[model samples]
Every structure is written in C-alpha cells, then in structure tokens.
Target: MDAFEEYLMTNLPEAPSFHPVFNEALQAMLLAGGKRFRPRLLLAVVDAYTPLLRESAYPVAMALEMFHTYSLVHDDLPVMDNADLRRGEPTLHKRYDEVTAVLVGDALNTHAFYLIANAPLHNDAKVALVQELAYSGGIGGMVLGQAIDCWFEGEKLTPEQVDFLHEYKTGRLIAASLKMGAIIAGLDEKMQRELFDFGLDVGLLFQIQDDIIDATESSETAGKTTGNDEDKNSYINHFGLEGSCERADALAARIGERLASFDAPLRRSLEALLKPYLARHKTK
Candidate 1:
C-alpha cells in the first residue's frame, strides 16, 4: 500500500462498540479499491515542481481522496444513482444502510477539510487549498453539477450545456487537484492557472470517457453501476458514442501538447503522470 493508504489505515475514525458499525461503514467505503487518481495527481504535480515537498503533500492528497470517496458514496445512494456496486464491491448503502451511508459520506466530507486545515503547509496555502476544494466540491461545483444532472434527466441538453454540467460536476475537483499542488509548491499565479486549465481539459476527457464506458461496458467491468447515464444528460447522450470517443481523443491530444510545451523535466514528469490516462484514450 501507498503512504496515503497507510495514513488512512492508521488514522481512520474509531468509535465505541455501540456505534462501531458507523465507523466501519466509513472504512469500508473509503478503503474500497480505487485508482487514487486525484491524490496521485496532486503528488505528481508536487513532484514535478518540487520533489522535496512530496512528503508534505501527503495530507493534501489524502484529503482529496477522502473528498472523492465521499462523493462516490453519496452518488451511489438510493436517492441518487441507486447503484448496487462500487469498486467491484457493494456500495456503502448496499452493505450498510442508507442512513449509515449518508452519515459516512458526511463524515468523510468534513474530515477532508479537517485534513486540509491541519496539513503542515503554511496557513495561507492551507486557506487557498480549502477554498479551492470548497468551491470545487460545494454548491457551485460538484453539487451544482449533480443537481443539474438530476433535474434535467431525460431532457436533451445542448453540447454547451453538457460541457457546463460536466465542467462543474466532474472537472472542478480534478482542476483543483492540480491547482492545489501548485499552491503547495508556491508556484506563481500564472503557472497555477495554466495547470488548472490543463486539469480542466483532462477532466473533460475523463468524463467523456466515463460516459462512453457507461454506454459500452458493464457494471461488473466498470466495478460500478453502468448504463445509468442513458437517462441523464451526459456526453454520450449529446455526442453519441463515436463523437464522444473522438472528443476524448482530441482532448487527450490537446493535453499531450500542453504537457510537451512545459520545461523539459516538468514536461516529462507531467507526461509520466498522465501516461495511464492517455494510454486509455488510445486503447479505447
């Protein structure tokens, strides 16, 4: 396991036997296998910019993972997608109860901020990181996106509307992952914005690929619910499978070009970080 996993295992919430199951539900949802992409992205950005800061980046990375896991837990709730599986295992709501899953999600969301506020970085950096996460995952970001998706189910959204939805719902946190790393590294505002834009492109690509996967793959293969997007406003709904695939490819190429434009070592490090995602576009 990675240091993040170690930290999670060691620091997971503990409770009395009367409510041990609550904490256990949180652990099960969190420790369920995931790609850890957001945290890895944060670490990679730190590594590319300042290797010495890698150690200091762990808490922030874990915070991102926690926030992401919280989102997944809530997304799979009966009130949302009503998913049965996540990461190839029963969803929190499925294994436990709806109320437990809801509380676990809430706990993870708040704990994510606690981790950020208590991270070893300077106070100013911590403040900025917290603001970014709140904006990305809060009412104007992920929540807004989800609300739009839920409200507009079965409605035919224009391409622009679809982009707006995904940008806030899925892209904001991904963008924040890179921007948070830049902030931790003390990079200038210009470089931070550049990285944020790069993250936006990557985020769009990821969502488009996700829509494709939902259409083409199965729940077992994806380790989560599939075919759920068919009734919602999604890239596949607006762009169709072939168009969505082409758009994902185009975005991947754009991101590759952007990475290549950076300085030699930074370029190489960023490319290495993105290799798996880029490879997915090609193989798909």
Candidate 2:
C-alpha cells in the first residue's frame, strides 16, 4: 500500500496550461486519499498470482483508483450529492469551484485509460484492461446505476430493483477491479468470470454498508458527508437500519463462504484484506 501511494504521488496527471488551479484541483482528491479499496483489490490478485508483476501492476491499480476518484469528484458536485467533504478533506468542488471539479473529474476519468495504455504490459492485456474498465465504468454499468439512482430518488423501488440499480452503479466497477486484476494475471476466462461475480456481491455489500454508515455516522467519523442520502433510494431508506444491517450481515456471510472456496494464496490474501471491511456495517 505504501508503495502504491508512492507510485501515485510520483505519477500524478500533469496538465500544463494557462490555468493554475487546474493542476491543483486535479491532484487534490487523489492526494486526499481514501481506502484505495479498488486498487488494493486488483493488486491483491496480482500479488497472489504473479508476485513479480506486482510493481508492473501499479499503474493499473493507479488507473482504477483514478477512475474511482473521478467518480467521487463528480458525485460530490453540486448537481449530484452536493457533498462538502470526501476522504477527510473538502471535496474538489468545495475547495476549488464546480467548473474545476467537473474538469478535474473529466481529466481523471480520461487519463485512467491513458495510464492503462501506457502500462508496461502486453498490448493485448492493455487493450483488455481498457475494454474492461470502459465497459464496467461506462454507460451500461456505473453510469446506468447512477442514472437510475438519480432519476428515482424519492420514488420507491423494489428490493430487486434496488439490487439491479446498485449492481451497475457501484457493483460493476468493483467487479471490474477484480476482473482487471485477473486479466493482468492471465487467469482463465472461467476464473475471471467467477471473480467478477464474487466482486458484484462484494460491491453490493459495500454499498449497503455505506448506506448504514450514512444513516448512523457523522461526517467527521465517515470522512465524508452523512445523512445525505435521504432523497436517494438507498438500502437504509428502503429497509430500516436494522433491516439493512441484517442484509449486510447475510451478504457478508455469503461473501465469506465464497472467499473460503478460493485457493490458499488468494483466499488468505483476500480474507486478510476483506474480513474487516465485509462486516464494516456491523461495526458502525
């Protein structure tokens, strides 16, 4: 993780223009730092499979983090969640301006592909990484989920509908993180698919835990805005806090069982990385 952080610090996106704050805004959220959850997921798989490629995988991991950070930047914009804080710091929009935030998000989102394209991997793997990231993070996946979430804020959605909504909005990118790692490790198609499916469940549980945190934690404790999803169709909103906690517990259990089924290296790596996070909602 420290090595990953060092790579990010040194390889930050550089855009030189008449604009001074543009560069600063672009680097702000990336430096502010979150859990690096997506990047860590990708790297864990790489470390388990091809330990030698771990360093080479840094750019890919960084790309995932950049893409995720871009989403956070845009999601915190005035028109989205209207969040004031993220990663224990003021959001890009709050620190700079909406225009800066929008452009920074755009830069990070596009540069993610650039990072993958430039990574020192085989051309085919690079292309596959780009395709996976685009497909999962693009319109049919994360964008679709966000579209549904924003469009149906106050409207009641069925539990199934909510699952579908979150699967794309949040789950797809997370699933892609795992899939991308598998791609780098040159895993079989079947293995890749299995990891992707596992990641979807993990992603859904992640979102539920987030909803639980929003309902219960303060902005200071959460390192971001809380109680901001009142208008948003979240698990906590649809099911009361207790119900959401129960759902999270069940999902965590299933995820644990699946984790146990993996081979020793991957299982141990992921279990160590994920056990605390899987039951985070309960902790809150």
TM-score of each: 0.95, 0.97
Superposition-based RMSD of candidate 2 using all C-alpha atoms, in angstroms: 1.3
**Residue clash pairs of candidate 1:** none
C-alpha root-mean-square deviation, each candidate: 1.8, 1.3
- Candidate 1 lDDT, 179-251, residue by residue in tens: 9989998999998899888888988888888888899889999999898876888887887788887898888
Local accuracy of candidate 2 as per-residue lDDT tens digits, 1-284: 58989999999888978897888888988888888999999998998899899998999999999999999999998898999989999998888889899999999999999989999999999999999999999986898899899999889999999999999999999999999999999999999999999999999999998898898989999999999998888998999898898999899999999999999999987887798867535444
TM-score of 1: 0.95
Flag regions of model 2 displaced more than 4 Å: 280-284
| Cα lDDT computed for each candidate against the true fold | 0.85, 0.91
What is the lDDT for 237 in model 2?
90
Best candidate (score: TM-score): 2
- lDDT value for candidate 2? 0.91
